[model samples]
Structure formats: C-alpha cells, structure tokens
Target: MSAARSSGTTRVVILGGAAMGSFCAMSLRDQGFTGPITVVERDPSYARASTALSAAGIRTQFDTPLLVEMSLFGADYLRQTGEIMAFREEGYLVLADAGRAEHRARLAEMQTATGAEVALLDRAELSRRFPHLNTGDLACGTLGTRNEGWFDAWSMLTQARARAREAGVDYLTGEVTGLEAQAGAVTGVVLKDGTTLPCDWCVLAAGAHSAPLVAGLGIELPVVAKKRTAFAFRAPVDPAGLPLTCDVSGFWLRPEGQGFIGGIQPPPERDDHPPEDLEPDHDLLLDLFWPNLAHRVPAMEELRLDRTWAGHYEMNMLDQNAVIGPHDRFGNLVFCTGFSGHGVQHAPAAGRGVAEWIRHGAYRSLDLGPLGWARVRDGQPLSEGMVF
Candidate 1:
C-alpha cells in the first residue's frame, strides 16, 4: 500500500504513541496520506499506557446518539480484531434501577434510533436472560445483544503500532517538553533532551498528561487525571455466559478467564485526583466494590480477590465526554485528548475522523462535530449520562 501524496507539506508530530497515536497514524496511512508521520512516545513498553491497562469493553449503549454511533463503528472495527488482536463478543448488560428507569428508557430510545442492537429488558426478562444475576431490585435493563464486548486493548495497540511502523510511520522515543508556536500556529516541538522536531501539524494525544502540554500553548482544556481501579477475583461458581454487567450503583463486573474483573465509580464528591501512580486501592475494593458485588450477585459473596490494578482516565470535567477536532485558535494543532475513558473504544473512529480532517480539511466519514472543543470554549457541554 503506497502512501497518498498530500497537496502540501504535512509533517505530523503526534505527542503520544499509544493506542490513539498509533491508530491515528494507521488511519492517516489508510486514508492515503503520504505525509511524514512521527509519533513521539516516552514509554515504548506501554507498561502504564491507558490502553494497555483499560478494561477494554466496547458497547453502543450510550445516552447520546453521537456516542452510540461512534461505539457502533468501534464494535464493527473490533470485529476485525482476529487479524489484528484478540476479541470476544460476550455482550454487555447495563442495569437500571427504579430511580433511573425513565432515563434508561430514554437512552434506549435514542440508542435504537441510531441503529444500535440494544433492547430494554424488564426484570423478569433480565433474569431469564441472565439467570446468574440478581435483578430483584432493578426496574429495567439495557442489554447489547450483538456487536458489544471486551477485547485485548494492548494487543490491538501493539498491532496498530506495528502496522503503522511497517507503513513507514516513524516511532520516536522521547517526551515532548515544549511547543514552539508562532502567530497562533504550532511550528515545532521540543523534546526533553533539547531536540527540536519541526512539524507542520501537531496532535496532542498524551492521555492524562495532555492537559499540562496544551496549557503550555495557552489552551485551557478542562481535562484532569482520574484514577480507576479494576479488581480481579475468583467466584465460587463459574461465570460462564455472564455478560459485562453494570449495576445501577455504578459497579460493573464481567467474566475474565476462569474468574471475573470489576470496578465501581467513585462517589461524586470523592476526589479522584491521585498521583501519577498505578497503585491498586485495596480499601476501595474491600469496602465498596465487594459489598456491591455481593448484593448484586450472591455467588460473589464467597469470591476471593485474586489481584488488582489501576489506571487513569483523561477525564473531561466539563462534560465527561471527549474533546476532539482541531483547536479553535491553532488550526494546525489537533486536539485528540480528554476521552474520559472512551479513548480505547472510540480510537478507531476518532483516528479516522482526525485523519480525514487532516487529509480533506473536514470530517468525511463520522460526524464528530458534537465533540469539538468549541463547545468547551463556549461553556456548552454536551450531556453524556453514561459515564461509567
């Protein structure tokens, strides 16, 4: 596959080489962009990359139509994971209690309108479909019957990186320390080792560290790092046929290998800002997660904790959704950060959209207008209720 010739100079410098960066590079190549694409990554091992540490669930059960549409594309993209990475269609079940029944129904209407394969299941239907679950306190549930599940995100990222490299994309190991901007347009990026890489276009995809990087350019993105922990446990009974179930209490669990992996959303008032460390929070698991699991699944009452790990969500505090597209001021600098945990699933579509924008000066495939930074600048945040 030969790279497409660009109309003008298009030397792109991506600040992160994880899932989003690699996928963006692949998308550019796939879209016939023959520009020099350089991806700068500090950690090539991806030991702490959010894509490698994510729960890796993909679904179309979003409250907004745009999100549903993006995730639907993501699910279809993951269907080809057999050639790129490992994937499984175990399905996802989102439970809604009486308090959120109306909201859940509204979301279901929107999801169905967007061509999502989601069904609103009553309590009896939920129990019939998932007998292992305890749906006694639920009013209704939204179940993704098809094109939804989990996959090995690390494998996908690695495969994408390898493909991008094979396609002539340069993968450089360095940390971007500064950006050189002239007359509101980025001109070059400076590495920590005092090396300058001049770029015609710059992309900020540094995950949780993107906020500080953009701040250096006088952009105020309301993105912060929020820590989320996933606990692995072994239940007394087999969790076969069990879908990734998210209870009304914001705690979610799913079958992983011979056991299960799960986590819970922290309370709204709780400060989730933690140090840049991936230390598992044992207290959160033993205190909050276990109790919720026991209440939702009685078999989990006798479950034993196997292990635990943590990661950061590049949370968009402005709206809990993604902030994509080019910057309002710097047209040459693209904004691909602030996914707030949806980066892994939406990377394929986002990368394609960004590549299209760079190639044709517009989003030719998926309409990502709703996720632009203009809304953030205007104080008009798009409401995305499904933030777990």
Candidate 2:
C-alpha cells in the first residue's frame, strides 16, 4: 500500500515530534493558521531523544548576536508559558578560562550590543555570587542575571505537542520511508507502514533521522547524527542555588529534578556515529569529564555518580551550524535541521520563523535567509563563534 497523495488541502506533515517539530506545530496554531498539521513520531518512550536526554538548560548569553536574539526570544516564550510549562527561573552562569580573555571581551561586547541582561563578572564577583564555587584557577565569567534556567525538557515537549494537538494538529506514529515529490516540490511523505500523508508543505524536523529520510528523495543534506554523552550525579551537599554553569572547556552542569547533571562535547573524532547506534560513551565521562571537573571544583569529588546516557545532535558539516528555512531546489519543502547541539534552546524562535515562512513566504521577525541552503550551495559560511 503506497501513501495517499493530495493537493487541494493545505496539509502540513512534520517528520519528527521532538522539541523543534512540536514547537513548529504549536507556533503555527498560535499564529492562527488553520491548515492541517500532522506530526509523525516513531519513538514512544523518547528515551534516546535529544530533548529528553539533554542536560536541560537554557541561556541567553552567547557570542553571536543572532544566536543571543534567538535565545532571548525563546526565553520570553518560555516565561509567557509559565502557567502551562511550569517554567522556573533558575538562572545560568558561564565560566571562562583566563587564557580566553579575548573571547570573553568579545562576548561581553556582543551581549551588551544585543541588549541581553548578562553580566561579566571577575573571579571575585563569581565567588561572591556563587560562594560555593572554587575560583582557584579562574579568569572571568558571564552570568545571565535573569531569564536563564532549565525546565523539564520532556514536560516542555509534551506540552507543546499536546497544545498543537488541541489546536487541530494530527499526529501519526511511524518512520518516514520516503517522500513523494512532483515538479521538484514535496507532495506527501511515505511512512514505514505504507501510509502516505499528503501535505502542501513539509518540514524536515526529523532531527538525527532526517538524513536518511531526505536522502530518499535525492536531496543531499549535510545534517549528520553526532552523539553527545551526558552524566548525572547526586550532589553531596544541597546544590539549590547552583546556576547552570558552563566552563570554558565546554563542560556544563545544571540541576535536574533531584541531582546535578553535566556533560561535555566528546573530542571531534569520537562525536560521529551511525544512525542506529544509541548507546552512550561512558568511557569519555570517566576519562575526561571527571579529571576536568576535579581540576576546576575539587568539592565535586564528593558527588556520587549517577547513570550516564547519550543522544544525537544533527550536525551540519558545512559550518557546524543550522541549515534553516527552505531548500533552493524545492521551495515548498521546509527544513530546520543541523542545529548541532543548540536545537533545544533555539526551538521557539526557529519554530516561529518556520511557521511564518510557511504562511507569509518570509520571516518578518528575523530574517533566517542567512541559514538557508543557498549559503551551503554557494560555499559561504556565516560562522558564528561560541558553538558548544
């Protein structure tokens, strides 16, 4: 049985139901678009999903102005949904190395220029703010004085999907086998169950699984699944006021429901993975993470080790950034893949921008044309620094 195809109805089928896909559906309905939106998700447990397995944290202090703007917009949306999301303003603290003084100065300048309420603090100020922190070998840090925190990422994702459903977004559970196209435009998607869902617009929000699905249509996307491993530890003492702290070396820690969670990017060679591999690299945590944290905060030596897990980030090879908006060859097909690791925090604004692009053919809030596939095709890189 082949998937059914249609043209009259403005049906929109999204490929994934993680944070980005669900957020796009929610934003479309919020903006009063009455078109039919359908979401397809294969994983019922969502255990291996990035949204669920991430070290749930959010921050607005970024080096790139566009990235900071996107984060601020996302933070604002989270605040507005406090009643629905049960969002807590837990705040975030970013620690830097003294050797990266130039980068620190640049980030401060960018934050101020973008009007982010981020503060640059010296080691003394950091110690004053976080009295428990050991600033023995520190330089400076950037703190999101307000509007930075972590929420139940699972809760946030479920809420967005639920709200989208309430707003008439249909959801299907299956793997995308292929896409149906005509005249270089997407018409519908074929699921593993042989069900064809017709749509006027299609978004490739399938996260790590996007590559194979889109590849079936002969559209070579650069998004590759890169594994990120994280570990959770029970704090020996009450780490209540512990802001989500990210070290200059890319290691980050924050509070989960009952314990403190942390992770660092694996060395570049160790980051690549095959599509089906979901197991975490626990050896990296034992070898690298422990030594790094022990060197920075000796008190962490008392923390009891919790279980570790891994998730995939759909990394774009071109610039190691996101490939947003539509593809050049197929205007009707929208894509928001290759977010590297920042997809969770950037979901809100990216969702809104994608929704507007579908409705108005342009994003009125912020022009995401810079992230379009045209740049990749043209061999240009709008490289934004401070990527973790």
Candidate 3:
C-alpha cells in the first residue's frame, strides 16, 4: 500500500488500450497521479475492438444496487463530456410477462430506491405509454425516465484514448505476450516482439483475452468471449416515443435515427463462437429477433432488415459481474475487466474506481469492494440478478 501514495514516481502499464484501459489512464491522471503511464494495444485502429462493435446501449435498470449506482455515475460522466459521442437520453424500458411481473416490479422499486428515475406501469398503462406495442402478453413494465439510453461507444473510447494521450499518457502499440512478476509484484510486461517494458504497477483490462493472458501465471480468470449479433433496420414503428425496450421474448430494440436496432445473445449451446470469427449471422435476425420484434411491437412486423454486425462480449463464466481491484496473487497487478456486456456503459465509473484504488490503496468515491478480486479467488460468485 505504501507504493500507492508515491504518485509522482509510480510507473504504470495498462494492457488493452480500449474503453477500460483508456478510461483508467485518464482517471489516474485526473486523480493527480503524475506517474509515467503507458497503454499498450494490439490494434491501434480498433477495427475489431468490442467497444467499437457494441450495440452502444446504456441503462440504469439493473436489479443490483451497486451496478445501478455505477450506471448512474457513468451516465452522468458521459453527459458531462460526451459532446461528440451522440449522447442520447431516451431512457430504457423493460417489459415483464405474467410470471415475472411481481419480481420485475420489485426490481423497479429497488432501482428507484437507488436514485434511478424509473416508473413501474401496469399492462393498461404500458399500452397507453407505448400505444404501438402489443401489450396483450405483458403483465407490467418498468421504464427508466432518466440516465438510461445509448451512445456511440467507439467514440467514447476514442475520446478517452485521445484525452489520455493528450494528458501525457503514452499510447504504445504492441501485442503483450505475458507478465513478468517477482515475489508479489509485477516487474515488467513482455511483448510479442520479445521486448519487456518495466513497470511498478500493471492493470489488466484485456477484456475477453484477459483470461488467456494470465493463464500461464496459474491464474484462472473466468472471463471469456461470447459472440453477440446486432442488426439495424427501418420499421413502421414510431421512433419518437420509443425507448431502448427489452421485451419478454428475449430480445431488445431501440431507435437510431431513421431506423431501429435490435439483437439477442445467442443460445448457450451455440454461443461458443471463436474470438477471431466476426461473421454476422443473418439467420438469427430473420428467425429469432424478427419474430420477437413482431410479437412485442406489431408495427415492427413490416420492418426491413439492414446491415448487421457481430462482436464479442467479455462474459464472466462464474457470474456475469465485473472483477476489479488488486489481484490476490500479484499485489501490483490490478484487474479492471470481466464486465460481461456492461463494460462499455460502466467504464467511466469502474475506471475511476481503479484509479482510486491505485492512488489511495482504497476506493475514495465509490466502494467497489463488492466487485473485488477476493470473491473471484474464493470462488464466491457475486452474480447480478439479470443481464441485458
């Protein structure tokens, strides 16, 4: 912990210069850390980065209180600095069927308790609010009236990376091969070119590739890559009153200018897509999402499918929750990955939290202890109630 206080001389290295790594670098600087910082990313173009391929949705409708808090904080941070990210505050609406109505209503109450502006509506009210939606099968619905929407995720990442570099954080383009550790501290980072960069502190934010990077160190991180497909389409439904709506039929949709976008996580049996395979599966859009869209919003029955894309979600196998804070085995190595699909939305808060941990040896603003490495080490899963 003594090393945390010596901010002026602490050398830090971050892996994967995407959303998480870039945010952490900027936040570290924001926290008054004058230490030398370097962010190494394999792809400087970020063409295939998860941050660039996401559906770009943000929401504070989760059932977990801490996650809800993170969402609120991230939303505020984005609005404050998202002039170029196309920040949208349209909000998120989740529909519940008869069986899950009471449970979902309970979640809405919890979200409201956590200062999330949300409202619970019954079937009639849901129909009144979204007149085009086929609410005959819905028992109730929850709507986040504020701080819940989508934005351009790639823009956010790019801005953070640029800001970090402008603040004197070095942006290194390299393929990290492994970590060099001695005793309990990470001594250096080994690159694919056999170049080793010495560092006093290391942050692992490699997203889906995080597990493989640390596996040789005898650390088994449950973070893995899961393929998610999204489609953009023009529909008869009105985009004016629509929110990023999640239906009971296991699909979510939202407005994007002249058209709407929607997608779903593939079934577990077929979700084992190779991390390198990014081919869009149009069959799922036709067979799965279209039917769900037609069932939820009758207006979308005539929707015309357009361009589609596929990406990987850094899914935590043990629990769909993020793991942050100091690594148990290597004290100098802080983890800021394993956010499942919520990485893009939670990056701001989580990155700030990481900076706090590195600068003060404790979280100053938000207590992210509940999502620390101890749980992952002890096999205690802090699972979220549900994921979107």
Candidate 4:
C-alpha cells in the first residue's frame, strides 16, 4: 500500500474518537464508504478530552500556504454547519511590534495570495478599529476579515459522533494498549481488555496520547501533551467589536459571552507540565497574564478574575504543524494527529483528507502531502511562523 491505497478498505478501525477521529468517521460515511467502521475511545463522556476543553477557535491565519488552504476549507465546512456547532465569525487579530512589523507584512502577503481575507492594519488603523486595545507600542496588526472565529468544540465533537453513529459507525469504549501489526502492516488494535479487533485499515488519531502507542510498534511520533491554561474574566470594556485579539503582550483574548477568556503559551523551559495535572494555573493570572492583560487593554485593569482551567495542547514539537497521512512503513495505518493547538478547528479538513485517502486511494479534495509522515520521518520540519 502506497500513497495511493492498493485496494479498497473493508473494515476501518479508528483509535481515539475525539474531534479528529469522529470527523474521519463522518467523512467516511459521506464518501460512501459502506464498510464497518469502529471508533475506540477511552471515555464516552470526553471529560478529559482535548476537544471538550479547547477554546474552539477557527482561523485562516496560518503562515504555511498548505495550512492556510486547509483552514479555509475547514472554515467553509464549519459555516455550513454553523448553527449546529455554535460557530461565530468574530475574526482573529494578531499584533506585531516595531521589530516584527516587516515579518507580519510578509506573512499577510503570503496569506492573502492564498485566498485568505487578511487585512494588514497599521497601528493607526488598528487603533481605529479596536479603540480599546493599547496599540501605542504596536507597529501593525493582521485581521481575518472573514472565514475566521470561534465555535463550540463540544458540540462539534458530540454532533459528529452522533451523526457518524447514526450512519453506522460503531462507537466502542476501550483503551487501546497498542497496535497489533505484522510485517510492517497494521492488522488489528489491541485493547486493555485483551480484545483485538481486526482492521483492514486503521486510523490512529490518538491526539496527544499518540506517542506511546506508536513507540511500542517501533515508530517515532514527536507529538506530546503540553499544558495550557485559559482564564475567564469580567471586564468593563464592551465586547461589541473585539476580535480574538493576540496582543503584542503574549496572551490572546476573546469575547466569551458576558465575560472573556484569555491564555498564554508558557515558555518552553517552564511548559514541562504533566498531562494528569488539570489544575488551573492561577499563578499565571497573578504573574504574567494579569499584567499583560491590563497592559494590552487598558480597561482590563479593572477586570475581575472569574475562574481558570487548563488543557493539554497536542503539540508537535518538531514542527508545530500537524502530522497527517499514513506511516511510511505501515501504509494501511493512517494518522490524523499532532495538530498542536488547532486540532478542533482543522478537524474537518483533516478528516476529509484522510477519508478521501482511505476510500479513493488518494486525497480528492485537499492534497495533505505537505503534512504527511514522510516529512516527520525525514526530520524536515515545515514550521508555521504564526500558530496562535
């Protein structure tokens, strides 16, 4: 089995039924693949799942052309199912200081050329549009004028699961210990309960937990679980036209109903937090976030800290981009993991790409080769300049 699948798959088993996995199941049905599809998830409630705890923002503000194209497709899909997923087009704004203004302009040029509606705003223009923001120290900003914003991740996950189930994809509750493979081809999935379900094709979309499973099978997947904390707060500023603002001050803030939610990615040295620690990083609010918040938006100085929570970013340390497509050796076993922080938003595109690969032996909609396994194997990282 090569990039073009040798034969049509009969039974497909997907490990980890989160946003990525469930989307694949739904797309499989949409592609008219009438085989037996099974999704194995450790938790049916998705209590600790990344999809359930994410900020659920979607955007077309990627640096890579392939990624920009991928997110554009996802934004379209989410818009078609807008009401179902509570999708909002509030847009995203990323700021750049004097030093990086030139680079930001270059990125905007690249994005706009890829058909993304990006508006590169100077400091004057940025201040005019979002007066509440403290753009005194900023040189420029890029705003996604259309096809960007937030959505309810829980709704997207549950709805996709329900619809995929209704379309005859079996949902199984179990923890997959490892892949059962022989002669470089995945044959079945071994559960913790000692049950082995055979599969003609396997999709390993285990998210942040994908590393260990493939390690046991002699594969290297650099995806890891990194902790990120988001805080909800109430401020006096109106949420009238505030986009999901990524200030020059290291934190991203968005309008979440009557209040707002914001967070910052910890520096690499201090981000080695265990996945099991779901406790809120209240210290961030006191030290980094609070100061930055008040500095970026002057009115936020009078804000009240409502609450805080944490979630694991399924990080691809090597590139910070997604690791998609099949394993170089195990062609029947495709992967849809390692989306870092944008998995939920990009799930629709990833799923459609993977499903098309499994059914038609090649990608029909988006050519997902740029994010494939070969890049990972060769250690050739196609890094994204702006991933927030």
lDDT of 1 at 346: 90
lDDT per model, in order? 0.85, 0.79, 0.88, 0.87
Candidate 4 lDDT, 1-388, residue by residue in tens: 5433323448899999999999999999998888889999999888878899999988788878888888798788888886887778889999999998998888889889998999999999988888898888899999998888898899889889989999989999999999888887888899999999998889989888988888878898999998889999899998866789887767989999898999987766778877567777778787888789898888999988888888888899899999888887899989899999888988989999999988888888889999999989999998975655
What does candidate 1's lDDT look like per residue over 1-388, in tens digits? 1122364356999999998899889998998888899999999998888898999998888776888888888888888667554567777899988998888888888888898888899999988887777888999989888878888898889888998999999999999997998887888999999999998888889888888887888888898888888999899868777789888878989889999999987666654556486677678876789888888888789888888898888899888898888887788888888899877989998888888888778899888989998999999989777877
Best by TM-score: 3
Candidate 2 TM-score, true structure as reference = 0.93
Query: Who is ahead in TM-score, 1 or 3?
Result: 3
| Comparison by lDDT, 1 against 2, better one | 1
For TM-score, candidate 3 versus 4, the one ahead is: 3
Considering summed lDDT, which 10 consecutive residues are worst modelled in model 1? 1-10
Clash counts for all predictions:
0, 1, 0, 0
| Candidate 2 whole-model C-alpha lDDT, 0 to 1 | 0.79
Residue 299's C-alpha lDDT in candidate 2?
A: 75
lDDT of 3 by residue, 1-388 (tens): 2345445778999999999999999999998889999999999998888899888888888867999999999889888985787879888899999999999988898999998999999999988878988988889989899999899898899889888999999999999999987877788999999999998889999998888777767889999888788999998777975789998877988898889988986777777777778888778887788888888888788978788998888888888999999888788889999999888999999999999988888899989999998999898998885675
Total clashes, candidate 3?
0
Residue 226 miss distance in model 4 (angstroms): 0.2
State the displacement of the C-alpha of residue 324, model 3, in Å, after optimal TM-score superposition.
0.7
Candidates by lDDT, descending order: 3, 4, 1, 2
